[model samples]
Target: MSTDTALQVHSLKQSVDALSEKVDRNHSDLLAAVGKKKKNKDEGDENEERGNWGSKIDFFLSCLGYAVGLGNVWRFPYLCYRNGGGAFFIPYTIMLGLVGIPIFFLELSLGQFTSSGPATCWKFAQLFRGIGLGMVIVSSLVAVYYNMIIGWAFYYLFASFTSKLPWSECGDWSSAYCLDRLPLMENCTMRNWTATVNGTCLNGNGTLMALYNETLSKETMGIKRKLPSEEYLNNVVLGSGFSDGIGDLGPVRWQLVLCLLLAWIFVAATLSKGVKSSGKVVYVTATFPYIVLIILLIRGVLLDGYQKGIEFYITPNLDRLYDARVWKDAAVQIFFSLSASWGGLIALSSYNKFHNDAFRDALLVSLGNCLTSLFAGFVIFSYLGFLSTDLNMPIEDVAEKGPTLTFVVYPFAVTKMPISPLWAILFFIMLVTLGVDSEFVLVETVTTSIMDMFPQTRKYKTFTVVTCCAVFFLLGLTLTTNGGLYMLDLMDTYAGGWNVLVISVCECIAISLVYGVRRFLNDIECMIGRKVCGFIPWVIIKYWWAACWVFITPFAVTCVMVFSWYDYTRLDGYPLWADALGWLMTFVVILGIFIPAIIYLCITPGTCGQKLRILTNPLVEWGPALVKHRRLVARYVPNYVVDPWGKEDQNGIAPSDIAVEMQKQDAPGYTPSPEYYAQKM
Candidate 1:
């Protein structure tokens, strides 16, 4: 070799050595600064009093309250009746086991591990931070419309305190078409109405028809009728006539606006202190509904035709399984019922003490949610059977969904029993309690996420909660207008429907695929260990959860999205603009996932490959929230995997190789293991 070339090589080696020494010094200083900051932050955390569940029971009830919502009372019974009766449970159970519990366990563990809300928890994979943003938006949209339903319940509960139910005889709200009872038209033949037909019997047009002799005749027997209860709901509760459609949402009903305000006030008061306050509130809001449900069930079973209703609910039609829509409905119901992908579970679990056995909580909450749906089915169908007998109508005619089932049909059914007003009060109170639990929890999710993103706001939790609830209440006022129900329906269909499925697909992929299922399992092991309760296996950390998170969950949720798109039918009677608005809302959420990712890639300072690697890597702060628990975490995953300056990233050291060294502790120099650094922390 040339002498000049050898000198240049020696100079380069010296320069590299000097740079390495400088980097090591800077890293040491950085470590010290981080440690001091952590110490100060820990002291401040104690002074400020971090929000936590008051007890283990507080966490359980809060989760249960959020999971088992109004859907259990209204939606599930109808779906069970519509989709092969008892046969629907087959798809429901399959979806629950494969898709429901796995995702539930994932969210609970993720939140508990990070001690952060949905938005901030994505530090593990920053590229997917948009998922958290999308979750917040979806929850916000739902909160607006959800409060309106609660307002309607409040309106009913207020009306029930009177001696007579307003819907019983339909006072001022009744129209000429309102029929409290069927007419004595035994001799008349029901037929389609025509201008040429003139008779003294009611016509199919819901109006009186006159004959040439002005006497009642069989020719007019085709007249249509509407129930007084239906008129009360349409005119009194909804005032649907004020607005022609979504395009023209008429004047707000002051009464409904007041009721909505009351509901929001209750929610804000409950969440005044964040989860600490909400934790205590859930004890009543969560358990009261069960008491009312059991009471109603006892009352319903004593009714005459309840046996028929139960039979209708449980009578399995195996043929219905052949329909794809049945499976889709089951998947949707299970997803929404457990409140997966909504961020509430994550937010609720985030307040739990670290290592609180979230695995057991997940199992208990999911099981409670499913069981409540089934139990509520018995109560709902039993009442429907009684309604069928009292009205002398078929059980098919008695069943309804959404507002009609709870506010209209159920209220009318209450009027049929002895001491009708007492029963009416109990029913609406149950609705209010059930709805309040869900409403406050949704608000809590939003507030928790906000505080997570801005730690400074944690000290002013009450103000934060009130501000959020007030914003949501103002937004919900539009739904209290005459055409609000139409708007509510549109939002419900578009905001929370397919977008949620898409988000679920993204979440499953992000945590299991991009983050590496094996690494995630190791983290789970670090937190909860192999067995819970000394005997029950944490099966979710086993092969079953691995398969579901990696393959089954993503695939199942994708199929649901595809089927929903295939079955997409435009809402009848809605304007094209309204449909476009719905789609626009949906796209906004979908873009929430993509736009931030593009921005992240553009701003990151590195080669495309380096940027991708950094984006996929877990943050240094991604381990257990408490430093104490990270020792076990370090035993499993190398500290360098999270530390940017660690040789794992710079020297192309494989995680497996580092794992071996962590166990052997035979490294040449100072090794940055958790035990070594945690002491500094």
Candidate 2:
């Protein structure tokens, strides 16, 4: 061949070689993708095979931890005191038995059986997962404000060291000192020239003059006069707001900021490792509250007026029970207090192992929570009785609202006790721990759901959750200021109080009626590898949950609405914006349930061909007709099963088949017979 021909042939050979190399690389890339997919599948299968498996003790502890929070210690007792002293318990117990316990078991069972979070568990039931999502959202909202309260506890813990008696000190200097305004004290104390003062102190010539030779002398003389009458000074302190007593330089704001930071740091650290860390934390977090309760109870009862407090707590008048409204209030209290039927428990329970005995666990947790609430009431009332006696006030006067109980009344009690600083420190520390743990878990539940829904954004989910928490903290800060009390009341009553109860009842109804209660019960029995007792079915399905949802939810909502409307119309300073926000939140929660269910039902028919469709996908549109379709599909399909990509696999083997297999395995007469095999063949 010629030289030119040889050169062309050489170039051709090189081109072929490069093409071959490219093909090989592409082939390797495809194999790698396949291998990665398989590896993920293997890991997931191993995780699943490890099965709905958790240490029973750990599971129990976690459930207990989630159920019992600062509410049990700080909120419940005061609620009891305000509602009707000991009379509250009659309705409280009735509510727990009828509503709380049933809803608790329902959420626990749904979670463990589905082996999914709140969002997924509802989807598993082929119901509106929005309701579950609403619970998650509500929890997240709550966690934000809740953490802020924990931050306050943290602030108190830090302030305990610097102040002589952080809770008891009285003076204008006291307020300034609590707020860390030492440098600004002189400026703040300067008389306002703009004020119209008409007093002899203004001076004989009507020219303003210093009350004493210098500011320091005036301060010293004031202190001297107050020192001899410390009791009188304390009375004055009690009458005035802390801001009026303490100098602006007090460490209160710094403490609050420090608390917020510390809370964030602790929550971030605890959750950084995910469930493993949270689970371990729960062991202490759940139990420590009880320990504190025991200590407080022992000390509280030993006080001089302990019997009076106890009488106030337990003096149930049958007349209170005669009013249906009182019973309704009790029911609402129980629902809020136990947090049953709330998506929070449902989401948390979803993390439980498939074979976990959630039925029994739910009962224990619910009962334990209620018992703690009752115990806490006794501890609180006993202390209040002591305070009443010491202050020469009525028990009714000493017994105040929730915030007053925690921030004022309880502090007053501590100050009167021996070695109060130590007890105060311990009490606040316990509150911080209890509150933070619950708050962190709530944020994590929402974060986990977000991560599950958008795996591609997993890297950013934690940051997103932290940011969400931070925003909530800021909002809570606004609520922490002197005038924030009214706003807090509005939020608590409309957003946190009545709204939560209503949403919970709706959730239970959605699960019961839409999902079919019988199916859920069966799912629970199979998942736990045992038969649920007959009582659960009869009580949960037939009467308890149904009655509460029908009666209690409506009544509470009406009361709240009436109160809100009256406030909006009559109260001069009522915040219309807050009212609007409250209604908006309520609407979001109410409509949230139906939205996802509708979407899932709508696309389910076409979803079979487009198997990538998922219920959690934000792109999905929800409508009533779609929900109907989902229900129809779920009747024949096992809606709970998920494909490798975490999408619900509706074509998987029917749940009924699995139920049958489980029954056979568990049946007494399930032994294989040679004659049976011959007949089958």
Candidate 3:
């Protein structure tokens, strides 16, 4: 090489090295802090720990991705329409402040305070280890069918690649009454309606109808035929009627089965390398969907009937505030949208450093979830408003919830837009990514639980992730059968619904009442480097937060749960037996709270009162996973302590502390034993 070329190369190398040195100098303390508790992979290593996020942004986005998922985009919009549009915000916001954020902050405290998964965080209340188990169980149950929802999005995504959207027209999968009248209805007036005779209806003139129903005014318009989209969903996609009930799942739909397999593979591939990879994967999974949401919002607002849709979505009817059911729905939406009572919250926080400011992090995530849901409502309702105008139907008739709103209403609306295929692909891809982000954490929650229980599995993460994917995939197969939607609806209603409320109620009671809210707050202050008592006037974060946990949350959640059960009705299609089975399934998860208590009580050597005392006390084996973590905790909040077991740590204890016993020896970075180890503590 010539001397000039060599000199240029040498100059570039020197410049790069100089820049690197500057960065190292600027971030020296940050680098030192991060490297202190780096992941350890060694034989019989007690200091073995999971890797944390590469940076704070990773954790924030990961939490955002997990909390604001499919429900935020689809379910929240429909619930707003059904509950009271603008009026729904009152109860929703009220619940958010009173019940939602408190529980959110509580879980963050419990997990970060100990650096443990949900199952292992229950040392504070040994009798309620079942609460942790219940969280994992509910998450596992929801994860099965949740993936099936993604599979449906995949099917539509592939179907959208056609020259024309397949659900655009009616054929063999349509009902006899189904009719396409977009052009024909263009010239028709409000007086023009579907006519009824003795035989059938062809373009609103029906012969098979028993009578003329249009004599009375209906909020509905152009009801002479089923929309091609609705027919495709009911007839081609779900094929719901063949099965007797949840009991008869019917034959599997091969297309959906394949899609389900693909869904599991998608999730497994995302989680195969654990958080080391997933922390980076979320960069796309979490943030890119906002781009699609923005595009849809802009396109929707510019449509022909945008004003009407926004009106139906945001206009308030104050009368709804009087209904108890509206309040119940508000609570349910908060629970569903924020992903509270799910094990994912604890599992996600368990990866944080000892002194991470989780208080600020929790506020960011919870409020971000609410804001996303609110904005998504605008995007959805705008499209529905357009559909209403185009079809000459009322806004109410165009809005729906759950799968129908997502897979049916939205997909059909996309087909009507310009460059329909492009919009369809982007919309479905957003749906898949949003759902997959949450599923990633859910799959990890299960893996984290099992790994925490059996530390050796950490070395075989790939095998464990694949095995989890396979097991959940096989379990999800029932939901891909001809009657899959019906089974999904049933599982959601039973295995998924009230069980969440039960878990939330049980957790609040255990944490606030049994574990002691003040003590919990102390632990949190230790981590966040600030007291809960803040300078927000009548609203100190710690004082109000503690009040909610101790009084407001438990009371309010109990009332809602009671109100939910007061006049519960069974699903329409299923027989009486199915309702019984649904309740039975719900009870099974709640039963987890008792199972551990029963076994522990039976095994412990103590009197009845002694057992009660021991059951309520903190376990002796609980403390920081490493001396370094403990020191960090002490350094930030010097007055705070981690003496849960009350064992001496250059200090003394008085009470008969609760004794926690687990079969597995592994914790965050230390193994527990019957006798406390001073050096480890």
Candidate 4:
């Protein structure tokens, strides 16, 4: 308890601190020296380690192509009509604000800032690495059945080139129930056909006279006939005429096998060189569908009964807004349609130049996706209207989703058009284009994540792509069997389901709580600039940051997940084993989330709290990908705890001028000069 003893202890502590500082300084200097030497040695041989889009336009088009996919056409229109017509947009746009644009921007910013794919991008918070794995799992499963859909589109496209569309008339593939044209039974005597000795109409339906006349005293719903188009799809396309269920899968259909092979071939061809090839390919694949959609819309509007279809599509039923299911549908549609959390957005945006303005790209692609979905509603419903009048069915009856809408409803509608074959060709072509881009982009997402994790694999890009495509094609052959339609439906129902919702929720938690929202914003600011250009852009960027902090996106996605589970329906007619299998698939994909976290925690050397803190913190390497931008980050945001430059303040105090410096950047369209960073550094 002596003053001399206290003074001695303080002096010894100061000496220890000085020694630690000296050691740290020497370690940093040694690293800098080694880095400089390596740089000098590799200056001539170093190529750009990662690829970029040929231009900003290539990036935009690739995003556009992937965002505006087949779902916009087949799924959106039906959802709109089903969820109270135009009234659906209220929830749709709301969901877009809460979930779509925010997540879209988040993924793009994550990839662009890190210059990495989904898997390796998690270097920001290693504990959440499973998010990237889960994303890849969803993308991989989706790619398999999604390519099958593309194959079906290809099958229909080739069939459309015939002098007469195959589905336009009953053929050998037609079952006993196929009706080429509905017999007019208005006069109680069916037109164009007579009751035969077998007590059936010549057109393959039970005699209307027998049903209508005999059932005069009873309530009769008529013969319940099937369309020739339906028969063609079931018998010829799916070859499922006798398929009882998934357990009844018959021999693989060689024709569809050829079509699927062709689909994979096209994907491999486009992705052979990664973004370089896909970027150029998007110029065609991305824009072609719009032309067809516009043409079809125009043609559709001019058709009879178009008003009823358009009315059914846009006629807002404000009451449906009160339904939770409608809101759930809107949220699910927006999430899937924009391809959020699917890893495609992350993969596509990861190819940008370091300083590329992902902010503008995010807005452009998000708004474009929404408008495309709305515009597609007009195109699809207009045809549904015309088909409604032609078949004497209600607009609701003709409207459908999934393969039913794409193959049966649309094909039958086209058959009723002038230049039926041409319309058929254009329609199928649009489906192919819409589907192909999404299919390959998902494949790219999977490939990008792999190559990023193992940089050495990047050199064998073509070989990697071929192997990926070949593997997917082989797996997809299961869906080419007689009962594949049932299997595809099962996969579609379970593959993504609640799994992606879990990832989205995890992403929000990781970014906001684990990684720290303010720090993430600073990192983003390092790439896109602290001051946004215009008033609206400024407001948007601010709103996005607020949304991230407020947990709006995760909360919204969580609610949707709850509603989805509440509304979950067993895959009809599939046995209990099939349902169990679907759940197993979901569990396996979800395991992608927890397994990595556990493995990461186990390997981290520390007590529980220390290990968690370390796992949550970004690696020193996490920041802008380029050297200059990283230097700017170190100079401007030097208070970040894990600065790679070793310039972090020991006292943990950020510069008081940080706010004033940002204010100085507030000038309209202000751009930093190289000298600004140079002087600061």
Question: Backbone clashes per model, in order?
Answer: 7, 31, 10, 1
For model 2, the stretches where C-alpha displacement exceeds 4 angstroms are 1-54, 124-127, 173-254, 457-467, 474-477, 480-482, 532-573, 594-681
**Model 1 RMSD in angstroms:** 12.4
What TM-score does structure 2 among the candidates reach? Answer: 0.68
484-596 per-residue lDDT for model 4 (tens digits): 99899999989978888898899889888888787777667677774553334443466566565458888889989988888898887899999999998898879998999
Q: Model 1: which residue pairs collide?
A: 199-210, 199-211, 202-223, 203-222, 203-223, 204-222, 204-223
Tens digits of lDDT, candidate 3, 542-656: 7887788888998898899898889588799787887887787788788876798899889878898898888888765454565545555565443545454333344332111
- The candidate, 2 or 3, that scores higher on TM-score is 3
Q: Sorted on lDDT, highest at the top, how do the candidates line up?
A: 4, 1, 3, 2
- Alpha carbon lDDT of residue 195, candidate 1? 31
- Which runs in model 3 stand beyond 4 Å of their true positions? 1-48, 181-224, 241-248, 531-540, 631-681
lDDT values, one for every candidate: 0.81, 0.59, 0.77, 0.82
State, as a TM-score between 0 and 1, how close model 1 is to the true structure: 0.84
Tens-digit per-residue lDDT, 1-681, candidate 1: 899999999987876676566558645755565456556544433212355676789889989999988999999999999999999999999999988999999999888877888888998889999998888888888899998998998898888898887888747667755655434332345544333344444567756543322222333554444567788888888888556889888988999999999999999998897777888888888999999999999999999999999999999999999999999999999888998998888888887766678778888899899999999999999989988887676787679888878877788888887898899888888888898888877888889889888989988988999999999999999999889989999998888888888888989999999999888877776667778655677664477788999999999999988999999999999999999999998988889877889999999989999999999888877765544455567776755334333434445332322232222333223355535533433
In model 2, the worst 10-residue window by lDDT is 618-627
lDDT (Cα, tens digit) per residue for candidate 2, span 238-356: 22233332112122244455567678778876766556567777777778777887888898888998888878877866666666656656766666676664566766665665555
Error of 4 at 450 (Å): 0.9
Per-prediction TM-score: 0.84, 0.68, 0.82, 0.83
Summing lDDT over every window of 10 consecutive residues in candidate 1, give the lowest-scoring window: 654-663
In model 4, the Cα lDDT at residue 324 comes to 96
Angstrom error of the Cα, residue 432, model 3: value is: 0.3
